[model samples]
Target: MPVDQPHSSAPDILHGWGARQRGGRIRVKGGGQVSQIYAIRQAIAKGIVAFYQKYVDEQSKNEIKDILLTYDRTLLVADPRRCEPKKFGGPGARARFQKSYR
Candidate 1:
């Protein structure tokens, strides 16, 4: 299911391993790293996606952006759970959604 971006403007990357689940909804839990984000996208584009959540500091926001652009696999879409509040958070802060796995 990979997007096969050879003809498109897709980035070069792919998804990774299993999710490390969490417990009762914490307030600021994250899933993957910036790299992992793209990894998830690649998974979806490739159609074998497993997701990771990332809880980054203000300093890392740019890194996350890099991940979004440099890798076609990392996308703004795909992982809706990751996009929502209980996980990825907002401009001022992030909220935890209680890890879905463990």
Candidate 2:
């Protein structure tokens, strides 16, 4: 089943890039930092795997079939949809509206 809608992070990454704002960095397990752009790619790959697994024939040797295998190698980033918003001891993924004093 193809995805019913575009993934949210796709637009976020594009907008970030267009605005010349480099994304946040992730620390590697062994120790090193990498841009969040890599995370976006991994998320996209995971989305593809989830949506297209039903259509892919594992026994097939076709070129198109082989392309699906690429999704299996995602190791850096987990899909945003599967993750809960970081609460950080406060409201999650939400901003508090400022009180306006007239």
Candidate 2 residue lDDT tens string, 1-102: 124134323423323222234355433343122324445555544444443445555442233224534423333244355545655544565655456799
lDDT of 1: 0.40
What TM-score should be assigned to candidate 1? 0.23
lDDT at position 31, candidate 1: 51
Model 1: worst 10 consecutive residues (lDDT sum): 11-20
Q: What TM-score does model 2 achieve against the real structure?
A: 0.26
Write down the TM-score of every candidate: 0.23, 0.26
Total colliding residue pairs, candidate 2: 0
**Candidate whose TM-score is highest:** 2
The window of 10 residues in a row where model 2 has the poorest summed lDDT is: 11-20
1-102 per-residue lDDT for model 1 (tens digits): 243334233423322222233333213225535444455445443322222223435444444445555654335455445343343543433644455676
